[model samples]
Target: MGYGELIIRSYDAQNDRGRVEDFERRCEVGPAKRVFLFTDTLGDPMCRIRNSPIYKMLVAELDSQLVGVIQGSIKLVTVHKPPNDLAKVGYILGLRVAPLYRRRRIGLSLVIKLEEWFIANDVDYGYMATEKDNEASVKLFVDKLGYAKFQTPTILVNPVGHRRFRISPNVELAKLKIEEAESIYRKFMSSAQFFPIDIGNILRNKLSLGTWAAYPRGESWGEVPSSWAMLSVWNSGELFKLRLGNAPFSCLMYTKGSRFIQKLLPCFKLPGIPDFFHPFGFYFIYGVYGKGPLSGKLVRTLCRFVHNMASSKSKDCKVIVTEVGGSDTSRLHIPHWKLLSCPEDLWCIKALKNEERENLHELTKTPPSRALFVDPRDV
Candidate 1:
């Protein structure tokens, strides 16, 4: 059966769980030659967007078999016009089609239905992210759907090992209360692009491990240092797991060799690679902000702290991940492995309302800000 028999309907967790899970397992993502990634939503397909205040998921069924799925959520976010000027934006994620369903237009039908829902909810703009190298996805949204490329962000990833990172002794790290964290972020980062108006809800989310600030030892939270930095962690590891497929031989050899060496020389304490062959989880770092000449160094220290913190967790967190605008200055200090990171993650957007087309066009042409506020719930 083809598009004629395709039916787009709301996703039901009770009835669609098995079919959806099986479909996701068969749809491996990334380049075929090198390692590919599979995201397991831990049986809850809506885990990514369930935290949002408004969200929906739709699935396509062909010949009585589930063939495709897409999820979208709406939220008010800061636009380029003014810090106070907010727009209701809808985010699309977890778009997938069964391997055999490719070229049948089932994917298109699912996205169209989701966009219809976004329009009904009064979304000003709709957007989604994918790897720059994903040619098929790029063509589908930009070429087919008439969406324009809006932003190119980088996905920074750093492996977590047994070794602890060393931060400068001059700096001190302190945990901040939820209100304190909210105050700091709003006071300094409110002007940032895409800054979520519901940031407090995110910080208060059960999955949010906590927020922290790094400044001089003698300094107090009351007195903000010019070189200070702040960050928050989301326990995404609890929401889902990631697995690497088709790994190169060299990577396997290095991981195995490092483990063998560590066993032989306990004193060596070499940082061995995590078990990639099996499914593993990761911690997501978001709300990265800094200032002053020493701010870069402080940001680096904060990233290392996150690395060490993830390593200490009882769960199997193999990596620390975050996304930042391509031109974001703080990215220069964030620790990430090039081999595991994506340099150019493409984001495309379309105006759901015809009247908002001009605003969307202006956004696409505007230069990226130095800092971008990545909402952890989007991941």
Candidate 2:
């Protein structure tokens, strides 16, 4: 078969139908197994490239036949606040190429093209993620492209059958009616970081099992209003939830997503979280706000509530996952939360721009510190 001509261009909605079909075909291969396809029908690609912030559609034309395609997006890093020196960061997501086109550097070319796009758009930082088990793709990013491992968010797996989790003492945890939860959410919106949990979105999340809150009886950690956690049960046989205000223990419950920000504001921003990291199958354990000793207790209480809820939801779902900054002080306090052996790696590149380089130098006096990028889901 002849090697294809690769072309990278702006997305055209009219051409997407063919692209979607091509994408579906590629998904039959093992490399695309993890890609969540969203369809108007069953199993459509969840990632609508047309709706993405900055998207690229790469098509490889072999002689005249379209043999391969790769799609990706660049979005602002919204979860973690950037250091002053590196305020503008964009992330690359949903990268895939046809299996037949593998080993020909098509994937690398797609990434390089996206990097070029990032540089041109004045985005000085870029990052991407892949599962640790994906050795081929990992090699492509690390060896071929010169991207380094910046962060590694661990992925913890627990069998769905093992349903053993308990709530903490000295704190009262209970489920709140949906209306009550929404009211509390609205009241907290003023102080929340990512406010206004799309009520519609919440309703659409059929998996949202319930919401829980924790209240401290005494003056433990300066006015701890009852902490809240929301549970989402996925059809994939996974139970997920988020805990607000409690650190350490609580961070393990939810995946980092927009809902997390709305639930917790004034919380410490973990570095190197890309926006594309969806909180699927993972539980968010803390509210987005407040940095104090009280955060840990609040997280614990919320975790207890979520654990109880998970047991009630189903006997199938077990194990909780959350992400925290390597520097998060609360993480230091938790000695029993088993750390995963291999962490998800975040690979980033400084978009080579003369002006930005000068500004970065003036601010940091050194190259900005690199991070071990972790996918929000893995965290």
Candidate 3:
């Protein structure tokens, strides 16, 4: 039988030890960056998906050889059509196919099964992200699948240890408890893309260090502040290192042109190669929003304090980052890596239903999710 007859099934933890190695190998050769592979560091590939309350992981096997895998979550997404409208949606990520098993419809099969999962969960919409330059991935989602090119969002990365941030003395960084943070998020940032309605659960997660708010010092407790900004720190230590020389990519390619045989046994490994993934954990600053003229100042203070907190926690955690759609005006607030950044990556999506809803215009249309919010967990 052809590879098309491969058996597709939910992840099998006890019987899939070798597949984890194969999965990581595929990722090493695949377009997705290795630094983002948190599963590798976690030891068990299925831990995160199995542990998450809303996620599912799937794998493809051909005669007992694992060839492909995919996973997703049923999410309640917030949109900007009517501004702050909510929709039940699904997100597909961690798509991987073994290098030797490409071009046999395995990927399409995995996604088709995932779509079934989406419908089963009662979600009518599905989406996933890919780099703008990755033609293979873009083609798979857009051409093979019926997904439309949705919103393109800029990813802003900040290095915490590079320099000390100078938060204004007048601005106080009040670290709010989970209850306070959720209450504040509900009031101000409800319109953001994927703004968690269950924000309390997110804040209380073990990975979340805490959440903070920026406001004028000595301000009285009120329903809301005139000039304010809010952000939460998430620990990404589980994603370990993928350095230049040590990474599988470096071994498979040469810095200069070489014969085909040389490519096969390339020992490209060498000392002094820089590590792409952070040694210290990464702190993702998300749910950032501001209002009024003083909002800019409030935002800066929050970033600085977040940096300070990360620094004090340990020497290893240094990078901080966030993503907002290109059309979102809120991007003007945070200090990001000006020289180093991904311009805007596309979020490809499709609806599981036959009928199109009016409130989901931004999500289903061509221009797509202009002011959408990108949760750190989604990354």
Candidate 4:
């Protein structure tokens, strides 16, 4: 496999779907030791990026066979820097190489090609996320590609079981209309880094079930409550299924034991862990915001609402997932199982132009704020 023999080209769904799907299956995520996971995109390789403002997918070929693939999207986002609080950014995701092609530079070539496209589109910066322990990915992006380690976010995952939570009687929860949701996000979260300029489109998208707000019973959307919390849900379950791999015997036993006890003692209503060894879907929580001393309670109530709604609506949805900056105070309120949550999800970024070097330097030197916005589409 000589470097000269590898070819990179734009992906054509008509001709490449099957091969690309096959490529995705061969690329399992997470470390092999405990629990590796693979995403089943349900035959649509472009499903994740299809909803973005501007997006493209590129495939690497070796001897007419698909060896690697990478996807990217460009959008104007908030950066909160001086002189300009926004930047034209490109997000790099879904990068994968065939199992046999590891260390062959296929992954590197694919990323370079995608970044070239980003530069061509006049994108100021390009960024990506990976597990903190993924040394291969860290080296490729940060060490070789010159991307700086930007932010560490935590992925909080709560399993959706046969458990229902009663909302605090004092808290009033209301579903926000699309217009109301957009207004709330722009008003409260526009200052957050990476806040999308087209949040209205995201809220209106079919995959977005809706946004909900929790506050004191007397307050309403007309007049924002002093102490409140709001969040939006994305139906990621419709986009892909994830299956855990290389499970430990202890985890397996715990799952089985919990379920056995629940079945044997029906009145106890224990929330047994779902069987993660098999494929399962999940709902994603994004645009999380809260304030005031009671905000944490409101956030917890909103999370509970989402859990009960998911449990009642879909058996396929096994988990409710949310990603928050590691330093974000909101993480204290979100419910999650420690065993299933990732405490340090790493994000790396690089400036694509010389003029943007200062901006990049400033961003890297400054610690990430609690307001880092995780785009639901990227998840």
Scored by lDDT, the top model is: 4
Q: Which candidate tops TM-score?
A: 4
Task: Name the runs in model 3 displaced over 4 angstroms.
Answer: 1-4, 29-39, 47-51, 80-84, 221-224, 239-280, 357-371
Clashes of 1: 0
RMSD of each: 1.7, 12.1, 7.6, 1.5
Error (Å) of candidate 3 at residue 233 is 1.2
Error of 4 at 303 (Å): 0.4
Off by over 4 Å in 1: 1-4, 82-84, 266-271
8-79: candidate 1 lDDT, tens digit per residue: 999998999888888888878775665898878898888889999899989888778888899999999887
Off by over 4 Å in 4: 1-4
Per-residue alpha-carbon lDDT of candidate 2 for residues 113-209, written as tens digits (9 for 90 to 100): 8777777777755555665567886787767776555444433322222233455566655565777656655554322211222432342344445
* Poorly placed runs, candidate 2 (over 4 Å): 9-42, 46-71, 75-86, 131-135, 146-148, 157-164, 173-215, 219-301, 310-319, 327-341, 358-379
User: What C-alpha lDDT do the candidate models reach, one value each?
Assistant: 0.86, 0.44, 0.69, 0.91
Question: What lDDT score is found at residue 106 in candidate 4?
Answer: 91
How well does each candidate superpose onto the true structure, as a TM-score?
0.96, 0.55, 0.82, 0.96
Better of 1 and 2 by lDDT: 1
* Residue-level lDDT for 324 in candidate 4: 90
